[model samples]
Target: MTALTLAAAQTIAIAGDVPANIQRHLAFMQAAAEHGVQLLVFPELSLTGYEPTLAAGLAIAPQDALLAPLRDRARELRLTAVVGMPIRVAPQTGVLIGALVLGADGSLAVYTKQHLHPGEDAAFIAGQGGAALEYGDNRIALAVCADFSHASHPRQAAEAGANVYAAGVLISEGGYATDSALLQGYAAEHRLLVLMANHGGPSGGWACAGRSAIWAADGGLLAAAPGIGDVLVIARHDGGQWAGHVVVL
Candidate 1:
């Protein structure tokens, strides 16, 4: 396909409800597939929601029972999906905040949040590797929540020859107003297309903003979801620019 169709869903999940979250994510993936979207992205910590209190108890190994269905869904839909979850690597080391990329063929790749906020430092470990995955003629670099706010994060992706950068985020109510502009700025400076998926409703006693958005390499906002219930935003890119309609699915 000359034009790449990308979609993101801003959905909510109660803290620690893995089954429901996976079901919701699968529903969105199915919708994206039906719409002929090549890739679908979900919010950060989407499987378990942004519940720091449950980090220790909820953390799961990368290859665990909880994620098997998601892998199957990706293969079944023949769609690339990015989902975030808290991962436990070792006992001494705390959990790591991670986003896993499931290729249409069932291949797996990952990107962890290298920078942890003050509140997350105690519960999550910072990731060191910077990686990018190629799919459907697009070099996609994946970033976790808060990673895109730093200049080095997007710069690393751009330097790695990534034309598109995607972030799975949990943007709290107050945090959205400040960080959204910064995300846009990063895209502009790096000359890369940026896509961010954020949680929609309340989770862990915190209200979240569901305004998932897509920005052109020039930093122009192509599509933005109003902060509300679950919503999907789609953006198409052609000739290194966003030149398509913003469809809500």
Candidate 2:
């Protein structure tokens, strides 16, 4: 089988700045493509930080022209990227935490957060999640910040024939221990390769704990960022083995 490269883009978002964040995302995409990464995942609300109050005003349709640059870059680099944003689907009154998938083939898909954390209901509503992403022989299930907290979420993904589980999250230091443990447990229980992308700095008044990481099917730690900053945690599956590395950008 051919090798597959995956990466977690641990980025620091400029609060409520979509244009700046897009440039940052572009930079990460370029770096990932240089490393031959086929799939890259970024933190929840990466395009607009984790500020819920700003989400409503910032929400746009999935096909908004604002994302054209990102889409073009993905097609040019032949890299598939899952980027987080605030989006409102037609007839949906409330904003949803969206993971927008930009396929290498210039296709677009959306994955909304089905589960809402406690305080989130004030700013957003739970949404019907999107479909898993299929690349080569791998099927990937996507999760926004709070979705992975529920065991049923990952279980359903595995039952649906997903071999890779990727989550875009904004985890704070206080909740890091519990959250990371849950993600790792899911990996071991489901025997699915897991990848987590987290914010590299504070956002939405929360001090984020940026230790983005990846684990093999057995829950073995493959690669992780030491702390916080703009970096990429990459895992490569080749020759029937999984290996990892980090790129500080």
Candidate 3:
């Protein structure tokens, strides 16, 4: 569990197609394993391409077979993968936009989105708060889009002694600059290494700004996707310093 390398993935996701997206995720995970990444993160609602209109019907149950391939791949590669999907909050009630953490030991953990965007609440239920996953000495906190924008979100992570803050967002071109600045602020103020995973193609009918990136605890950019396609921005930590590179698949 002594994780040294982490990656943020930017990839094309098929809207409303869980099986196809899972296939895409498997390919991405394969590429990440070849690059020696201990953990790989995908953008929000990656499995369903942020299509809120189809969320309720496409909500993945905890024991669904669609998740089996991902679980098996994570176990085989011995690398953790944080993937996005819509999860049922309650039976026949509604769903919560969620990030599912697949551990190398074949374990699954979920973190639901605590904050929703302007009109997302109509389809997705808001969660209570953010959640963190642990790997050896590293405690990585999970945050969806608006959750990272809130000041109290990082504070909560700081209170929990988290060393990494990971986010999955579908940022448009116009919003990238502002969101990146805010994320950098979180990295500097909280001393948490920040990482973001975003879509490489259209999702939810929005043209996504594909710039999956990572920032050092000191707020310096470590790595970022060049343009689009299937890309990975990876950061490796050594003796308190981080070195990074971008991998194209």
Candidate 4:
């Protein structure tokens, strides 16, 4: 079996600054590549920051010119990266919260957020069904910010034979404690690897909890960020259990 090393990155996002965000992402990507990480995950809306009201204007289509360089970075580094961005599905109707997966070979897989927060419903459309992709020896199930709040999301992924449940979230300051417990419970119930990447610091007038975390199948906290600044957390699944610590570099 091919071993997979997972890296969950928490970044301080600059609101509406796509270029700066991309630069930060590239820097982390380079660092992860140098550390021999196979899969790297970032927080939801990492590219454009989580501004629900402004998402309509900032949303990018899948084929937008801005993503070309990001795609190139993934290919050049030979790393699979899950980057969150606002997606414009239609011209003016609605947008979607999406995580665009760029493979080392330049292929792309898009996972739209299945569950939208109540506040976000007015701005974005929710996706239907579940999706999974193969990465090394693991079959990864993707989740957006609010998807992990629903028991059915992780349950369905477990039922679908997913060994890894990955979530990209923009966790606000108020929601940290609740979300952490929810994630722990989800991991325990499904007996699957739970990896989460969350935005850190304040952006677009909102402050996010920087507690990006990874849990083992038994609900053990394998790695967690210190609720401040940018963090790169690495966790290893050894003998069907998650082990290792958070690396802030």
Cα-based lDDT for every prediction: 0.82, 0.95, 0.88, 0.85
lDDT of 3 by residue, 1-249 (tens): 254899998988899988899999999999999999998999999989989999988996765778999999999999999999998756786788889899899988888889899899889989765457877789999998888988899888988999999998899888899998999999998998999998998889888899889998899999999876789999988676788999988
Candidate 2 TM-score, C-alpha based: 0.98
The order of the candidates by TM-score, greatest first, is: 2, 3, 4, 1
Going through the candidates in the order shown, the clash numbers are 0, 0, 0, 0
Candidate numbers, best lDDT first, in rank order: 2, 3, 4, 1
lDDT of 2 by residue, 1-249 (tens): 347899999999999999999999999999999999999999999999999989999999999999999999999999999999999997568899999999999999999999999989999989888999887788889999899988999999999999899999999999999999999999999999999999999999999999999988999899999999999999988998889999999
Q: Residue pairs in steric clash, candidate 2?
A: none
Steric clash pairs (candidate 1)? none
**Candidate 4, 1-249: lDDT as tens digits:** 357788888998888889999999999999888877778999998998888888888898877889888889999999989998888756775788889888889988888998888877888888763468786678889998899888999998999888889898988888888998998888898888899999877866777888899988889888899877888888866575556577776
lDDT tens digits, residues 118-236, model 1?
A: 77887888986456877656788888877877788889889988888888888888999888888898889888888988888888787887888988888898888876578778887
List TM-scores for all candidates, in order: 0.93, 0.98, 0.96, 0.94
- Candidate 3 residue pairs in backbone clash: none
**Per-model RMSD to reference:** 1.9, 1.0, 1.4, 1.6
lDDT of 3 at 30: 94
